[model samples]
Target: MTAFEATRAWAEAQDAADPLRAFRDEFHIPAHAGADTLYFCGNSLGLQPKGVRAAIEAELSDWAELAVEAHFRGRLPWMHYHEYVRDAMAEVVGARPHEVVAMNSLGANLHLMMVSFYRPTAERSAILMEAGAFPTDRYALESQVRFHGFDPSRDLIELQPDGPGGTLSMTAIERAIAEHGHRVALILLPGVQYRTGQVFDLEAIVRLGHAQGCVVGFDLAHAVGNLPLALHDAGPDFAVWCTYKYLNAGPGAVAGAFVHERHARADLPRFAGWWGHDKSTRFQMGPHFSPTPGADGWQLSNPPILALAPLRASLNVFTRSGMARLVEKSRRLTAYLDWLIRTRLDDTLDIVTPDDPTQRGAQLSIRVRAGRDAGRSLFEHLERHGVIGDWREPDVIRLSPVPLYNRYADCFGAVEAIEAWVR
Candidate 1:
């Protein structure tokens, strides 16, 4: 057999040996002709669980039969729909239910969090973020600083990479904190950076920020369901993440926010909408703005149950698997990917993410050496060959092997594809 045929046979044999191979049946894997597509884009849009279709259809039925009454009378009443998700979301982030709430989209939620936490005094008005954070986050921080009358060009402190195409150094991070911590109102970072896949030490950052009186928050768009997170223990003033990525929720699903319990009754300033009102008196609807107790107080509008439905379906599986066991699987799966890449693809590729599993999730960033079109070229190559991965601008390709649905053989196949492409 040719190398490609041998590779295919190897994939089959490994799949046959996989313990989690059955979980693939839980998803409707995309197919063309008789073969399944090799899907690694779960870092961007996770494949739908077979159960999600039915969960969503059930909502549609309730909508058809009950109409607006679905708000209060459906099987899962819309009036308290967000409640159904509260505990599960809390579990995903390791927070108490009261400290967590499903709200707007990721960017919108970040802005809401900013309004409540990014209180800049003239003396400490700068915002600190890693250079090359997700564009949305950079835009969010810029607008936030400018809105508060600070000049982003100077006040938005971006910690650039320490050397030529190298990662950010912990020493540099701490030095910046020590030098500018007093002049910074907030420190914003991704729990797992989108481009480089670098995982920040949230607790260490938070502890340091608090010592310097700087509020810390995370754009967990990449970290939420990918790794083990204890948002409460991390003690960030706030955090926001979307559900579409690792949670297997549908595209544009509602996002979640973690507001530490200390913020629960602190009279923190917020930009509120009707949904943030006290549930007990929400129907009372007189002329007064009474707030819900915790993270719910940060909400601005009613949730989209259509969006919530898939998240619910995904969370049910997570609840069953338990975060601890799933994280164990994630570590091994990503470790195997790292091992394969280092062992096979390193000569032609630069692995940009951190070397430590404790410093990343499932996504591995590959910097192809074939020039500016490398990201796009490699992306198309993978797709045409039936391997899927996400690409960032310039020359970075990201592959994530998700815990719930990814198999050990999938890891090996992806690495083989990368090696084949490079050679």
Candidate 2:
């Protein structure tokens, strides 16, 4: 173990000095058995913000009172509902307002982006992705290749990581693109890996793919609000992310997409819908489809006002706290958690997440090595003791202490629980 001392007094002192500590009260932490659970699973599903209840209720009230007129007359009119989330979402992802849009769920948005960006020719007809990607991304990419009348096993190029549960090196990715870029029509990778919590070099990957003539995209489900992104500057063809995790929206919340301004023109072949049509001409019910400029042109239907309201509430919190401050606190919290695990629980566990703050997000994937049951037993032990980290399939316990709500004391209590259980 290292020389770091994570004592209770030290934890309390750190919590006292933390500028973001007051924001913790804005969330509703769940109770396990009777007491409040430590709740360290924000990477999976975030705790609900206190404002979410009123936001949902407001939409419900408006719907009840106005009926169809709610589209135009409600406090937040449904006709232009998605517009409210645009600037906030753009700020979160570091995109231009015209380049980002709140739209369908993550997977759906990925498929929709692929529809416009995954065009393949006989000479360039393959897709390159990380080996062992999130199952949904693998499935979507595979189905996309099949739809293009190509064989997944033959046409999908995969770059292997440095080692099992390790980071994918930029050199390996560049080498893969150099070898297969001619045949690769698209390059799709995650900004932050879901299982290992590795943050990829998004700007480098985009540059390499473009130099090799491949349309690049990112599935930022783990990266969006967790990391400060510059999607417009990095300039991927498109990117997609869900709002439920770091964004603190409820389950199945509305997802978002970024389409580079380069593709905002009418010439792009997209599946058009009435909602994506020009708003002024849309009410006229024209015979032909004329898309709204930029990312909004990708919309398929009107948004769910109730579902979007929670995001509006949550984004307000983000706007107030600011991403830069949140990231600074996130790095400190994860570093403390890492230090505690190394110094206190060294014999029983190993952290799979990257040590460098630049190479990962808030999640720490701890691999259990001892005890009655390898992973699940320890996970259950933590839960029974009022700690609420989640267990991944084979042997990983994922704990994400969100900067907005988690405290140094929470980290201390979590490590103390492990120490008690292990002893």
Best by lDDT: 2
Error of 2 at 290 (Å): 1.0
> Residue 4 error for model 2, in Å?
5.7
Model 2 score (lDDT): 0.90
What TM-score goes with each of the models? 0.94, 0.97
For residue 290, what is the lDDT in candidate 1? 78
Off by over 4 Å in 1: 1-19, 163-165
Worst 10 residues of 1 by lDDT: 1-10
RMSD values for the candidates in order, in angstroms, are 3.2, 1.9
> Which lDDT tens digits does candidate 2 get at residues 23-123?
98899989877867888999989999999999999989989999999889999888888899899899999999999999889999999999999999889
lDDT of 2 at 332: 82
Among residues 3 or more apart in sequence or in different chains, the pairs in candidate 1 whose N, CA or C atoms overlap within 3 Å are none
Cα lDDT of all candidates, in order? 0.84, 0.90
After TM-score superposition, the amount by which residue 395's alpha carbon in candidate 2 deviates from its true location, in angstroms, is 1.5
Residue 88, model 1: Cα distance from true site in angstroms: 1.1
Tens-digit lDDT track for model 1 on 1-423? 212222456556655755555667888778744777777888899999889988888889999999999998999998888888889989989999999998789999999999989999889899999988889999999999999998998899999888434577777888899999989999998898788888888999998888999999999998988888999988998999999998888889888899999989888888877899888888787777778889999887888888888888888888877888778777777777777777777667778888788888988888877665765777787887778887788678888888777776777777776667776
